[model samples]
Target: MIQKYPVGIQDFEKLRSENFLYVDKTEFIYKMADIGGYYFLSRPRRFGKSLFISTLECLFLAKKELFKGLYIEDKWNWEQSNPIIRMSFSNIGHKYLGLKDAIDKRLDEIAEEYNLSLVAPSIDQKFKELIQKLSAKRGKVVVLIDEYDKPIIDYLGENPDKAIENRDIMKVFYSILKDADPHLKLVFITGVSKFSRVSIFSDLNNLDDITIDSRFAGCCGITEEELADNFVEELKTLDKQEIKRWYNGYTWDSSTSVYNPFSLLNFFRKKTFQNYWFETGTPTFLIKLAEKTQLYDFSEVEIGANALAAYDIQKLELIPLMFQTGYLTIKSYSPMSDVYILGYPNNEVKKSYIEVLMAAYSQSDLGYGVVYVDKIRQLLEKGEIERLEGILNTIFKSLPYELWQKENEHFYHAIIHLTFSLLGVYIQSEVQTSDGRMDALIRLKDFVYCIEFKLDESAEKAIQQIKDKGYLVPFSAENKKLVAIGINFSREKKKVEEVKWEVIKA
Candidate 1:
């Protein structure tokens, strides 16, 4: 069978008609019909959210012809289709700072089709006028707004006052949702960030957020089952190891152990599994947020609800922003402490994020392609602690002063192992041992080295954790010497505070 790849394309009908690769998420359609009147999904860009929204649009518009051979092809009742009002805010703020002018232009593109002349000066007025007319004419309206937070997010940092201005304007306009609830059948909205509930849904009391709801987990990204089942043919054309390493770590509620929709398609189309999503755009907002917070070593820190909840994020909501914006995701949720473990969604995100972080700090992207094995070989063969420490120190110094937790302490200690592996160093993070997690394990050229890093803790503690936990117990008889290192970091100092190395040199 010929393989199909949908790359940089979000339109549902087009993809369906063109016979592009499609992972059937038609189940979400009926689920949507059961959920609350309005829906909100927050995921990182290029996660197939736009396409999902488009699918919703097709369903609402009763375009059943496009869903043939899909899960929901025969499940939906086409007779109940409603008129969908779709709007995208990609180029929203070019002419309007207030909702009035910005929305006016958008209304002119969509609301004009209703044969209604919207001359309202404010967004609230224009929205009210359009909804009233559209509802009165069609009897029901299905509102699907894509990238609903784009205007606010794009305006931010570039111009905060304007974002604030647009926020208030959106408040008034969207408030009509409550006022026009009876006339609206289905409302689906998507955005990059989950802003204050007070910001967008002032009156959207029925807004249902299925973002983390385990039921609708597979609504956006491709699932592992879906990828394996559907894209197995495509997989045959790519390097299996590289593909998995780059795109396959995300496990959303079990079913979503999958590839990045964007990167997956791009890989098939371009015949390479490069950093497609990361190269698509630089998350300047996230970089700025990190710098502004001086949050050194983001990877090393264990974050919680206060970190993920959009409701309490103060002054840009960096952690919460990271979760919603796609840099991190809930890996594990502990009920006892109500703690959630967040990390890169997949190998693709991990590699891309590291590249971006490296570039931000060092003004150069770490060529994380394959040299990692070589680095691991060298680091372990000669027990080159200085070489590894020196590379990290130089990169850590490249970090802007604002993001410096401590000038001498490198914030990247969290991923020193991941970094080396990313560089093809063949290292592992949090490797298991009878003593404890070896923290890191580097293997290359038949040689293995166990490594550990600690900050605000003694080298003895770092090494002892390995000893107490028996972290190095796994490689005792692997035909090679086992190396262990406990490195301490000083936040105020920003570099390696001390390095204590011990090797079971053969």
Candidate 2:
């Protein structure tokens, strides 16, 4: 019998009581309880953080019946029950409503739940009193905060000043955890981004950030083994490799690769390959930041793991925003240099980001971009170089004037990169060759396109550079037709000016 897929079900008791399919992560949850007093985990939104927090609430409440046959049933102590002080910032409306007001209302509800008298007027003071009162009356308090950064991240784009103010308020609110350590049993915080030490967690200095810790890397996401073991019936009819290609590349460390839990569950239920998670929350602020900066290449972004965690209201680096928010993930890591190479986590993110970027930068609808990408693929497969040139020209000319007002090769490279990648074809940009680097290389089953792009120069010069630099030499071993194309973008005209090509049998 196939179990019901728990899509959008954040309540642990409800999920288990309804006989929903659950990938067993209780082993890691048990381990976390044993190891740390205060913990923080940074995962993309809807990656099972809420459900995990709910599960923690049940465990602390000693709801042992819920964990009947799970991994932690025998390992956990069922006699000990703590008063859980659950504070969720997940569904707060802080855009129009005041954030402080929201916190006060939630605190009021919590105080009433525990039947405690609140003397403090401020939100932080109320939180402190709740912990102290709960510890004195029942037992030590277990605090689980879900989406702790939502108040700040929600207003980051619309009102940055509001976001910063929220950040300061949040800092004071969380600082109580340190002072109330004597009354706290365990504290777990989950959010989308990990703000730096000096920013959000400055006062709460004892937070064990298990974001990149290998031991708990598989805590939040469904692993390959978990998927295969739990969904045996689903695998009989599905293409496993295709599923992996679409949703299984999010990694916090080099060792473990996890499937996006939200997308994977939806894929099984819908029986379709779609950008489920990306569509749910695309982060428009991030796409706009990518375009405005034009300062760096999104296709070629590399930063150390430490750099990826340094995000705050004031410092909005595109790399950290993308990396932490699930657009980009760890492609590889160099222990020697202590740097991590970040790229699109899976095909879903790659295609969705291109669609979003195209719409935002080119002022075209997503459907238009998809149709044009299909046209580009057809032209490339049939070796229709001139028609491909016309499509490129049309695409560039259609872009908004504000987009191309500044002349930056990185901007052009990013646009072209998105265009080809959206075609759902194999592509590599700025590929290194022995002599020099190739601007773009596209691969088809029967043909390969060695593309050289130049700005404010003749197409002939671009073609000469491809040959002079021996960019096509790497493809000599493949027994397919090699097509060399040189394209020039006129900075003055803000459009493609020339295209030259030659197809040679390999």
Candidate 3:
């Protein structure tokens, strides 16, 4: 029997009634409703935020018939139901019409649903009045907002001014939640980023942010166990490890990571390995932000707990935004210092991101990058030193003039880092070897290359430093061949000026 996979259908009642495959996340929903009064969750786009919100809608409405065999069926009270006020910002109207107009239109729709009229002059007042009126008759109102930051996120890159304006409108609109707290049973808001308090959540500061909260870490996305238990038939012919490598490393905390539900479902439907999650949309603004900030050290990017929670359009930080937006994820956590080390979540992201970055920064064709990666891999495997050097020179020489003019060392390092990474080889950036930290370490099946990159310095010095530092001492015993490569870039030319290499054994 072919199971119906809910690809774009977020309506929980329809999904359940139509016999679609639903990974039961109601247990978490039950715990959250029973435990909290107000909550905020941050996850990437298409990571099941909409579906989660829809589930909460059904749950709050006490639609017990839809959840007959689910985990929450026995645990929840079927007799008790609250009037649900659901709003999603994904389809909010024309940007030129402004956010206030969109809010008014949405409020009018809601008012019609309740068979009432709202005469409030502003969005905030309309929201407040609706909450009071609904809860007055229904006992208490349940509020669930999906894609709460869509209006602002959509305008972040092109119209930053509008983004800020929309944020102000949203701040005013969401502020009504706090005022209507007395009549609200549960308030749940979900978005892509945790916009800082002063910007978006100032009035709603009491809301508990369960983004990194360990208890609800598995709430939004499909967990490894959930996938195994629910989709056993889908796994019989699939490479489980490939699926894990492609979509299984999005982490909220340091543990209990989950797969992107959109990608996993598509993988089953399509029966192929591709970047389904990224293909939905890659924010050009975020990539441009990284390039503008010269954030090339993709490996050791770290953020404090406070910084990670900070998201203001006026003063946005690259590390936190990348981590929150799903381009990068929590690699590790330091309990003592309250910091998170963030990196590309999985192979799918790393590859897609590099292609995006290269295209954005260098205007290089993604297909060309893939071809160059294959050529470079073959060159390294055959120990073609001079040809490999020429390839590196060509890669740098082809960089766009605007990017070349920046002349930032970090930018150049990013180019090199991405080059080796695309080849699917073992690449350790800034590897701490026996004596000193090596710039990069690349390992293929038959060869190990110690790479040292220098600016405004001789290539000979780079190789000597690698040798002096005993960067290859740890690999001396390995039977595979070893090579030390030194690459030097000239700031004036904005390209590789010299290349030196020493093969230890073959």
Q: Which is the leading candidate under TM-score?
A: 2
Estimate the lDDT of model 3.
0.82
Which residue runs of candidate 2 sit more than 4 Å off their true CA positions? 92-97, 401-411, 424-436, 467-478
The worst-scoring run of ten residues by lDDT in candidate 3 lies at 424-433
> Which of the predicted structures, 1 or 3, would earn the higher TM-score when compared with the native?
3
Clashes of each: 23, 0, 0
Candidate ranking (lDDT, best to worst): 2, 3, 1
lDDT of 1 by residue, 1-506 (tens): 77667787788988988888788888887787645388887777888888888888888778878987788877777887666678777655634445566677777777767777877777677777777778888878888888877767766677778777767767776887777887788888888778765566868877887777788777777766777788677666667777766776554453345567788777777776567877778668787676567553444346665556554223677777777777776667776786777667666676666656545554445553234435545665676766766655654565566655343334455345435545431334445444444556666455565666777777777776666666666667787766667777766677766777676543
Return the TM-score for candidate 1, rounded to 2 decimals. Answer: 0.84
Off by over 4 Å in 3: 94-96, 401-411, 424-436, 476-478, 490-498
Report the C-alpha lDDT of model 2 over 99-146, residue by residue, as the tens digit: 888887787788789898888989899999888999999988899998
lDDT by residue for model 3 (1-506), tens: 99899998888888999999999998889888876499989899888888888888888888889999999899887888888888888876736567799889888888788877888899999999888888887778888888888888888878888888888888888887887888999999998987654568788878898889999899988999999998999899899988988888999988998998888899899998888888788888888898888765575577888888877888778888888889899989999999888888887788888878777666777656776777777887788867877788778777777776665777787887777667652233346565656777777677888878888998899999888887877777888788999988887777788888997653
Which is the winner by lDDT between candidate 1 and candidate 3? 3
